[model samples]
Target: MTMNAALIRAILRIIGASLVSLVFVTIAVFFITAVLPGDVADALLGQAATPDAVAALRHSLNLDKPVLVRFVIWVNGLLHGDFGVSLISRRPVLAMASERLIHSLLLAGVTALFAVPVALVLGTASAIFRNTLFDRAVSLLTLCVVSVPEFLVATLAVFIFSVQLHLLPSLASISDIHSIGSFLASFSMPVTTLACVIVGQMSRMTRAVMIDALGSSWVEMAVLKGASPAHIILRHVIPNVIAPLFNVIALSLSYLLGGVVIVESVFHYPGIASLMVDSVAARDIPLVQICALIFCAAYLFLTTLADIVALLSSQRRHAA
Candidate 1:
């Protein structure tokens, strides 16, 4: 196939994969949510409530329907952008989730903005200075950060920044300030916590990719031709490392989306993770299903993008 045709085909494949992934996620979450051992009525009203009240609440919520019928209705609602109501709050789940989703996305963006370049610089420097003290020190620090659990990092950040130094608030609260500053202040802790993890993983991947690229045949030839180290890295090393870096970035993006639940909860940041947790606790089946499907779609899209980039890179290298 022509190069353009090949690229189009690849894009189509990725879209198809993402759709399949969304379907699977919807099915899995539906069954899991359906099987959870709690009645929405019981969750809303205490267990000591009268039997008539429980039965009436169940009927009102359509929990009296067969599981298959309920799942069908839930899926239909999801396709139409309705995420049902929260049993506890009596609010539309999608409406409630929307307010927090923006916060989480902003926090992730801030963390990535700070983390990615720092990781690339540190990783490239360490790779250049491999076996030296600087390399060793960077390696050790990356390992330490990676080994620490996210919650521990969140707690330590709270202790040092919020509790002791008082640089930022312990809990994020929406305020009357300008939107830009208010968002920055509200999400500072969650952003910082996520940045720590992002930096560690990205640094490790970057170091490995750069080290390998720098040691490749083209780099050796550039050095033998009396090219400056800076020129060699900029011209050869960076291009060679782009494919792997793309993969690393995609993986990190997926992690940021799906892996921040604990960190979000620990820091009390009102993000999608927190929403999912609350929905699960209340057995809000529709909310849980929607969140799971959205997350899965995101992950699948990222993975597919990575695959396409890797494919194009490989094709270019082969043509060269």
Candidate 2:
């Protein structure tokens, strides 16, 4: 097949796989939430709830229906863009999740803005200076950072920045963000915690790709021909490694969708992850299902986009 046709076929395959994965995620989320302990009625009514009252609430919410039947109904609703009503609050799930989703997106965006550039620069510099003090230091730092769990990093950030230094607030409250300074203060800890991990991962992956690019035969030929390191990197190494770097960045950023759950919980951030935690605690299966599915869909979308980008880049490289 022509390279263009091959690339198009690969992109179509990625899209199809992503759609299948999303459907499986929806089923898994619905079933997993369905099996969790406790009932929404019990959570909402607390000690005041009697058996009869609980039964009536379940019936009203259609919780009395069979699990498979409920799954089918939920899937049908999803196809129509209906997330159903929140079991506890009786509000539309979409209405409740939309704002929280935006908050999560904002957090991810801010983290990306800070992390991506730093990762790229550090990765490139480390690759160029491979095995030197700077590269060794960076490698050690990333290793240590990656070894630590995100929650620990988050806790240490709160302890050091908020508790000890008193520079930033521990809670990332949106209501507290009125001015630019306040906005920075509110986001500083969570953003730092997230960026710490993402930067470590992206930089490591980028460094590996760049090192491989630098070690290529053309790069060696450039060195033999008296090319400067800067010229070799800018003109040869970077272009060759751009596709892999894109994949690394996309994969690393995809973690934010899932990893933000811990960070959001720690900071009491009013984001979709926090909302999902609350819904799960309340046994709000529908809301939990929707939230989980959203995260899965986003993750799949990013990976699929990265695959398409890498495929197109390969075609261009071949044509060149």
**Candidate 1, poorest ten consecutive residues by summed lDDT:** 172-181
Residue pairs with backbone atoms closer than 3 Å in model 2 (clashes): none
**Runs of candidate 2 exceeding 4 Å displacement:** none
- Per residue, candidate 2 scores C-alpha lDDT tens digits across 195-241 of 99899999999898998888899999999999998899889888888
* Among all candidates shown, the one with the greatest TM-score: 2
What are the C-alpha RMSDs, in order, of all predicted structures? 2.2, 1.5
Tens digits of lDDT, candidate 1, 223-258: 999999999999988887677899998898788985
- TM-score of predicted structure 1: 0.91
| Clash pairs, model 1 backbone | none
Task: Work out how many backbone clashes candidate 2 has.
Answer: 0
Candidate 2 lDDT at 293 equals 79
